[model samples]
Target: DQLSKQQSEGDSVIKKLKEELAGEKQRTHQLEDDKMNIIKELTVQKEKLTHSEQALSDLQLTKQKLEDKVEDLVDQLSKSEKNNFDIQKENHELREHIRQNEEELSTVRSELTQSQTQGSSRNVKDDLLKERETQVQNLKQNLSEVEQLNEHLEQVAFDLRTENEELLEAYEEVRNQLEESVAGNKQISLEKTAMLEWEKAPLETELCRAEKRVLEEERKYEQTVQELSSACSPDTSALQLEQERLIQLNQEKDFEIAELKKSIEQMDTDHKRTKETLSSSLEEQKQLTQLINEKEICIVKLKEKSSELQKELDKCAQTLRKNETLRQTIEEKDRSLGSMKEENNHLQEELERLREQQSRVVPAPEPRTLDSTTELESELSQLHRIKGHLEEEIKHHQKMIEDQNQSKLQLLQSLQEQKKELDEFKYQHEQMSISHTRLFLEKDEEIKNL
Candidate 1:
């Protein structure tokens, strides 16, 4: 009964151990599955990390390109602004020049009007002088006709006086003879002599009046001639003074015209130069606008690349977290496996002590020896079965451990690949930064020159 109780107790302990081993095997299988999952997650994380690094590199390259483009745009914009300022200055100068030219033109028009007025006045004066000369010639001809008429009148008067004297001598000789006959016809002869004397007296009075009027007219005409001659003598001097004045005015007008022409020519040259400069400035502005557009495109592309890199980085972080959890589960499984191994070693030591005590207490009788042998045989058979079960459980745990190890190795390899990719991306980013800085410096120098 005691042996039977010991056997039953050992069988119960073996059953408990088997149950524990089964539970530990299940745990180890779960751990192995977790480890495999972890390795897969780690692999996914490494791939994601590699992709993120590539994306980061692309983002950095895009950023650098955008920076360079921005710098170029800034330089172009600055140059365009300077050109605009210069054009504005030129426009202001042109406006000033135009205003001055308009003023000069107005002054020239006024001078021309004055010159035309002076010329018209001089022509009118010349016409008046010509009419006066014609009047003087007509008056001289009338004075000569009056002198001829006075000469004829004086000759007639002399002839009439001689005839009258002869008649008077005849009358004296005939006077004595006439005394004898006078008594008969004296009244009739006296009447005839009275009639003749009356006619002669009236004629003589008319001639004296005509001569007096002619002398008065001659004196008045002579005075008028002397005054006209004096007036005519100064006309030449007056005309010369007028001509000198006109010549001086013409010279002044010519100088002013020359100066105005010179100014106009200079203004035209300046205007042409300004137009050319404005055209060049417009071309530069167009180029600057084009550069700005290109910069904007580069910036958009850079932003897109940055977003993609961030997404990849996020996915890699998620996968890394999953890998960490899996690694912890694998560690727990390994600890459980070690504990089970220690329990198995303790059970083996207890079995060995029990076997040594049984060997020392052997009986000398046949019946007793036979009973002891049979009990020992049964105990040995049970021990062998428990050992076989323990060995099978250990083999299963060992297989799980090997699988975990392989999973761990795969995870490490993936991690190494990800790290190498990250290093490459970092190196590329540093190089880009250096190049971008150099380009920025050059752009700054260009701006200073501008």
Candidate 2:
């Protein structure tokens, strides 16, 4: 009976050992299933991390492009500000020029007012008219005097000419008389020479005969003296009578020589008187000619004075015409100045509009990064529903990426439109400034011409 009891206990122990082995096998299978699920979850996390990294890289590139666009816009804004400053400077210069023109216009208006006031006064006008009338009358009187003087000088010259002709005739007559007297004196001298020759021959013959007679008388007187000494008295009275006849003949010849000397002295006095009369007539003709020359010079000076007065009258007329033109130009300038003020107001409004537009432009936002710890916690909690949750998350991430891309594109379009508007505004502003400068230059040229 003890042997049978030991066999039963061995059987029970073997059965218990088999049951424990089966339990161990089932626990090993459960552990292996858990290990596989954890590995799959880990792989899904790695794929999500790679997608997120790609999205981050795309966001970085988009941010860099946005920063470059912002820098470009900033540079454009600075350039526009510089352009505005230059335009303002030009506008200031234009205003200064306008102010100077206005000052000039004011002065001109004052002068015009003074002239109008003077025109209204009857006393001033009458005085001016009287002065002009007096000047005209004086010029007329001067002209008449010059004409009368010229006539008087002509009459005097005529009388002098007539007197000169008469003197010339008298001189010719004296010259002819002198020539005739000289011819007569020459004939008389020739006749006297022939007569002297004839008288000399007879006197020499008579003298020779007288000397022979005297010699014969002397011999006869000696004979008579001898005869008287021998016998005296009767022939002495006859010799005395012969001596008295010879003395009477010598006295008659002396009377004829005295009469010839008196005729020669009378001829010399007549020739000297004729010469003095001819010289006095020539001196009178020279004096008359000098007087005529002085009268002609006085007439020429009077004519020159009349011409100078005429030139002064012409200058006064030209000045009056210039004053009329100046008044018309001042009126036109006032109208132009009014129009320029209106244009200046319009430009200031446009500048204000541009400043407001520049202030309205929007800026870019900051970028974000992935949070790894939060993603790991979320993955663990959704482990059983991982596939479904991953599908929904991927769709949501794609929608967010699409929305970000759309927003970036819209910003680019807006920037492009604003850049186009700015360029067009700059072109219009430049054209307006050019036209304003051209108008100002034209006004300046007109003023200079005036």
Candidate 3:
């Protein structure tokens, strides 16, 4: 008996050890599976790290390119600033020259006015000279007339003396008339001489004033001419120097522009490389995320497996307890079987009756219930009709959407055509504007010639 018990105990221990070994083996398999998953995840991470490193390299290159571009831009800016300073200086000089020219122009205008005044004075002097010569000729003609009148008077007096023997009274009257006429002629000559002298004096004074004005104007004109000559003189050397400077500045600007263009090209290349790198990095990140998700799923499965293993262990323990209870019942079965048979038959009958009662208690399908069924059928028909209506409405909506899409497509096509037309119109307008400008220039030239 002792040996049997010992053997049984040893068997139990062996069974427990077997169960433990099985559990441990399952645990080891689970661990191996987890390890494989971890390895896969680590491999994915390594690939991602490699991708990131490549991306980082690309970013560093891009950063370097950007720094170079910034430096080039800064250099260009400095050059531009210098060019601006030079241009400002040139503008200042041009303004100063313009101011000087304006001052000179005002002086020239004053001289022109003075010259006009001098010409008027010279004309006045010439008129005075002509007037003086005409006055002298008139005086000579009057003297000759006086001489002829005197001769005629002497002849008449001699004739009257001979006739006085016959008519002394008539002769005396004629002699008195002749004497009065001679006196009147002398008075007129004296008045004419006095008037000529008075006119000559004022004319001489005016001539002197006009001559003085003419001399002053001549001097002013000479000064103006000298000033104009000086002002009109071109600073050819300075202009040439400025032109050369401008050319130099243009060359510098071109060089700067070239540098900027190179920098921009480099920047574009860097940006493209960076974009490629970023895309690769994103793909790697996506892969890493997928791996992480897979790992999470594996972990969940492992946990479920562990729980299932625990449940199996618990079921085995429950089955062992049930076996122990069944063994005890088997030992008691011989004493109770005969009495249990009668009770079992009675219980069977009761169980059947209970089953029948349960069946009766349950609701049964009835033909009169067909009224609710018909109502439900009507509701179903209504729902079907509603569904059909909705389907028809959906079809109508689909047709409307299709029509809208077609209209939108047509509108887009029209817009494209309109854009093309606009481009053509713009080109035509540009051409017209150019032609107009040319025509205007030609017209201007013609007007200048006319």
Q: Against the unseen true structure, what C-alpha lDDT does each candidate score?
A: 0.41, 0.38, 0.40
Cα lDDT tens digits for candidate 2, 22-100:
5434533543464355345434433443443354344335434434554565454355344434434543453464345
Tell me each candidate's TM-score: 0.28, 0.26, 0.23
Task: Give, for candidate 2, the lowest lDDT window spanning 10 residues.
Answer: 364-373
lDDT-based ranking, best first?
1, 3, 2
Residue pairs in clash, model 2: none
**Candidate 3 minimal-lDDT segment of 10 residues:** 160-169
Error of 2 at 273 (Å): 26
lDDT of 1 at 354: 43
lDDT tens digits, residues 1-450, model 3?
A: 644453354346435544544654464465456536534643543444344335434433543443354344335434434443443454345346444544543454345345333433223323323432343343234323423433442343333233322222332333344334334433433443354345335434543453454345335434533443344346446434533643464354345445534544543454444345444434544544454455446445534543443444344344334434533443353234335434434543543444455457654533323333344334334433533443353344334323433432343343244335334433543443344344334323322321
**lDDT accuracy of residue 434 in candidate 3:** 49
Which model scores highest in lDDT?
1
Assess candidate 3 and give its TM-score to the true structure: 0.23
Best by TM-score: 1
Give one digit per residue, the lDDT tens place, for model 1 in 220-297: 434533443354454556434534643464354345445534544543454444345334434544543454455446
